[model samples]
Target: MKELKSEVSGFVVSLEAKAGDEIAAGQVVLLVESMKMEVPVEAQMAGTLEEILVGEGDSVAEGDVVAHVREA
Candidate 1:
């Protein structure tokens, strides 16, 4: 399993996938509000969403794990 992390510090806007949800590579798994703009965070590989390490409206910093994905 590979964990996806936030590229920068920001407030989470939305979670595009939930645990057990299968997703494709490059899909927007989460959105972050930074610099007053929405930044979509994409999956780096196709996999089942294993866990979400954060929730909407949560604040996270760069290099923080946002979600985990189990590769199909």
Candidate 2:
């Protein structure tokens, strides 16, 4: 499994990927509200989403593991 981490400190605004979902490389997995803007968090590689570590409205810092993806 590979960890998908937050790149900025912010509130989780939305999640576009879910557990068991097949994701493509560069697909937007989640959105973070930071600095009054929405920042999209993308998958680094194509894989199956295994878990989501945070919910909408949850706060996260840079490098915080947000989800896990298993090799497809």
- Encode model 1's per-residue lDDT on 1-72: one tens digit a residue: 998989989999998889899999999999999999888888999999999999999999988999999998
Best lDDT among the predictions, by candidate number: 2
Stretches > 4 Å off in candidate 1: none
Candidate 2, residues 1-72: lDDT per residue as tens digits?
A: 999998999999999988899999999999999999999989899999999999999999988999999877
RMSD of each predicted structure: 0.6, 0.6
Model 1: colliding residue pairs: none
- lDDT of residue 71 for candidate 2: 76
TM-score, per-candidate, Cα-based: 0.96, 0.96
> What does the lDDT read for residue 30 in candidate 2?
97
Candidate 2 clashes: the total is 0
